[model samples]
Target: MAFHEMLAPDYIFESSWEVCNKVGGIYTVLSTRVRTLLNLFKKDKIFFIGPFLHKKESNIEFIESETILDSWRKYANEQEGLKVRVGYWNIPGKPITILVDFLPFYEEKDIIYFQMWEKYHIDSTVAYGDYDDSCMFAYATSKVIESLYHFLQLQGKKVIAHLNEWMLGMAVLYIHKYLPTVATLFTTHATSIGRSICANNKPLYGQLSNYNGDQMASELNIKGKHTLEKLAAFYANCFTTVSEITGKECTQLLEKKPDIIIPNGFDSDFVPKGKMFETKKVKARSVLINVIQKLIGLSIPENAFLLATAGRYEYKNKGIDVFIETIYRLKKTYFDRPIIAFVLVPACLQGARADLKERLENAVSSQFPLPRPFITHELVGPLCNDPICEYLYYLNFTNEDDSQVKIIFVPSYLNGEDGIFNMVYYDLLIGMDLTVFPSYYEPWGYTPLESIAFHIPTITTNLTGFGIWAKSKGAKSDTLDLGVAVVERTDDNYFETAEAIKNIIVKYITKYDSSQILNIQRTSCALSKKAFWSHFIKYYLQAYDVALRKL
Candidate 1:
């Protein structure tokens, strides 16, 4: 079917945030689908509803008419109105309108806490409830839906409320009790239990830390999760997840399977593709190379291999520590032939920064330490002095432009400054020899999938969404294959990650001639075409069918 042929009924997806206010992969999933969604559902049929937390202008106005608002306010006041006026307003976008609710959290500031803990790219020493936060969260969820319900009632349009993840799933359960025929569709991008277990193999809090399967199933109210998800699985009109791997995980973990697997795709309008690269921005390329030199304080030879890696901070989970260690290991073997390894993973907290600093220090001292003066300045001087070092310094060190290869950490919850950093990352992506992401807990990573779409080779582990999807398409090997190199995530030390990076560097930057580079690019583009728009959109159509049949 043509891209325009797929249609999903008036689909209204609600989450804590979306692209304009992204904090995780969820934002990437929503934003990348904008073009495809517009083509599928057309205008008005698709709407994204989230809390209004930033510098957003609210134009669509509605008076709070529901008694539920009064009930929410009374409850809020009783709990001291923890969240600051979050009212709802509609923002116009092509193919869909975004309805944002901001009244419940009008004057509050605890968003920093949630953003730091759940969405912030940095690590923190602070605990989750250093302040009273639950009431406010419950309030935000309730009020947003309460406000959204009245707004949709005003529009007189029937909606299939598509709630993503557990927080929004809670809202769906509450909303469904009142409006049973609303045709709700619940999607668990990743189950809470599954993610928490994946992240640390323990419960999020110590309260349920010791509980085994049955005890955990009962103690922290697993029934509540099972109840919500099962209701969605068996009771809701339809259910979906971002990828088939994640969908399967949700079913097995939640004990309730989704009806469809809506794998994510890139927003071709934003990310560069095959023909897009042929129209390269030469100035953008030069600006990036300059930035790289400034960052490392070493000028690199023009022919020196440049490899890049980046993602939100989940350093261990995203396999960044392994990436760094790999570079350290490879540098030992290829010291004579310099290669610039650009690290671009974000760190969420001061603690995470210190931790990364310590790791980098250990790597430097063990492998690349200077002969004289232990101080940071003294050590970097020799690195800046060599003629080959002169090339490295200018190209990798002095080039502060993010487009070039340099270890650049982009922070979480991108706002004014960070948004520019994100754009730079996109620009830098074009110049990369390869991009590596070996995530241990990614439900469906957008990075590897996006890298291929951009015609850049990538490395993703089986633990990621795209890796499993690639395997589905017959991709194999621990080396450079399938336009992606799949590194198995195991108890085996960091050597596997290091080996994969070394192979990619050898295949793309070190060993390959222009003809070989062109072949890799062609393979990447072909793989992208396989994922392009067909496979994912068909799942959406199937979901619509399931939803309509149930309705």
Candidate 2:
């Protein structure tokens, strides 16, 4: 399709911390939604820019080929003082991508910070840790955009710079200031100060209305990121967030209302079909059971209920604390069926547990449980520092021969070679009967959506973006018959939410009606199909239109 005939911007340039790097949920959003975006524009029109972290080596997800813009690449490399790898992302859409080496920017980042402070009043005086590196990357990405824009002579074209997260907030400000013709869409997945508040164990929901973002940032020592996010949200041609919940967060915390609310959509291709699906599911189950039996030294029955809660290890913010409480509450109940709940949250792991590896190697269930039997891998840090393991220790899980519930904390990433489990996240995800993501401060609950996508019923709280979307679509907010149960989570309703989850699981387990369960699973798959990028891509197009018109 010709540029004039198409409804999309002439070129769509998107930058994220997770473009090629699989850091978090943002990777899921961009990588999965590429196919849908490509349908609107040609492969070259939609450009994704990210950091080059693979040390000049070829990344499995990136295919570096001869440049379509070789002249510009050469000029930018030598003349424009930029370093980038021109490539196509090896994903479903195989879209064009540019992974930039931003390390050189570190030397000039202080000067760049001064410029930002002068131009946008972004405070970076007290920034620490990953702040400098991320800011340098964002600034470098913007410079890359600027150089490419001038080189391509895309001055009068309807171009968009869709920058994601606070990490890319600098890019938004830079494009908005330097390239006025190109519209900028800044999306804050979660406000920095808001997340900091929750991560610091402060009561966010109840005190949100009374809280000032600047004051909280000062109190929490996150003024640099918070200020950049706030100003970016204010000055961008269009500000977008992932969900209604996160949009409200931006309004309250960042003090700028989002122009569009685009929910993250799933890729249907990730799911297998027919015999392949069943085969993977069976293998997943067998692996899960084998790991559990080996770790706990007990024969797990075929009817074991495999429940899990997997994501970043934010014990309170991700409601991992609540998940543990739910398990604790459920264990007190007298359910006849055995429960195998796995905590798949990756952390700073030393490696797979030596004792567990020995048991698995022998392919035999232990006659007795080993020490610290609840975890698959040992942590690099002390047990007291880890909220999950510390809390599990407090709960005193025996993992005995006749225990009702066996909790295994796999504190390592499931990349098909996590020493134990030996399967990737989705492979293990498929075998689960139920999943929970009762997040206290989730921008978008991709874990729960992924669970439902794989036909496993999930229980997520209304606080999440996905949970609110599920509620709006009328997915039995607190029932299992429809596959997803959105539990009502509140600041003070910690016990209530745990009780609700415990009740839901108990009922589902006791129902023992295979036909109804199968119906729920089918309904889950059907619901996920509705949330495919093909359906959700329209909202992105709407955001693009909003940004283009603003210019």
For all predictions, the C-alpha RMSD in Å is 10.1, 2.0
Model 2 steric clash total: 0
Model 2 regions more than 4 Å off: 1-7, 54-58
> How would you encode candidate 2's per-residue C-alpha lDDT over 280-399 as one tens digit per residue?
999999989988877777788888899999999888999998999999888787867799898889999899888888888887647777777788898998877888888988988767
The most accurate candidate by lDDT is: 2
Model 1 Cα displacement at 146 (Å)? 6.3
User: How big is the RMSD of model 1?
Assistant: 10.1
Candidate number with greatest TM-score: 2
Against the true structure, what is each candidate's TM-score? 0.69, 0.97
What lDDT does model 1 reach? Answer: 0.53
Model 2: residue 430 alpha-carbon error in angstroms: 0.3
